[model samples]
Target: MAFSATARDSAVAEMNITPLVDVMLVLLVIFMVSAPLLTKTVDAALPQIVPPSLDTIKPLQMQLDVGDDGSYRLDGRLLTQSEVGERLAEAAISDPRAVLRVHASSGADYQQVVTALAEARNRGIANLSVQH
Candidate 1:
């Protein structure tokens, strides 16, 4: 007895994933080849500096305290906002590169400290520091 070929089996119902894997690998290779070109380039030139002499005297410090009652003090002496510049000028004459340290009480207004700093700047005080 001989067996006969017959179309009695069902057709394939699931997709073959080999082609999908091939496409994904191709895309990966393309991206790998182009990745370096996508990077951004930056051009910059920095200046060189010569060190200064170390024998320079330290900057003189002037303290400005702002009290809770909106009062201002210059080195423990009470003064108004307008007086801060005048006093700073006098201090700077002794030491041109003087630092102004401004201290404000916890309850003091922020604007009071700002005004004091402005006045010090106007007086050509090069160094300024704020103390908590």
Candidate 2:
């Protein structure tokens, strides 16, 4: 049956929101009651250890200097690009504890410095430092 378009009859065509409100209220109460039970805590008594200092012990380190003239040096001795990777790999293999410090000149190419850093990493140097 079609409802008349009169204003009084048009009220029947509107939605009844009472059931929706009741469901929302029920969900809110359920969440409020269960919220506390969802959280859990555990007591932990863990021991702490102090880390070693960098300035304390100075080990024998290997230095790689990249000059603005595109030259490489391993401990002040000049080397070509091809020799850098091979020599660094050997040094890393000989003493894994050896730290490799890269000193790039101010005018040195950014890509060259990055490439040298990558070469050290690729050679499996564990401790690498850069001096810009």
lDDT tens per residue, model 1, 1-132: 654444322234456899999999999999999998789677789886755764455778778899999999888999887777788888878888888889999999998888888888878887989987
Model 1: per-residue Cα lDDT at residue 16? 89
lDDT of each: 0.83, 0.87
Clashes per candidate (backbone, < 3 Å)? 0, 0
Cα shift from native, residue 65, model 1 (Å) = 0.5
* Regions of model 2 farther than 4 Å from truth: 1-60
TM-score of each: 0.56, 0.55
Quick one: best lDDT, which candidate?
Answer: 2
Off by over 4 Å in 1: 1-56
Model 1: lDDT equals 0.83
Candidate 2, residue 45: how far the Cα is off, in Å: 15
Per-residue lDDT tens digits of candidate 2, residues 33-115? 99998896778999876567854666558999999988888899998877999998888888777799999999999888989
Error of 1 at 43 (Å): 28
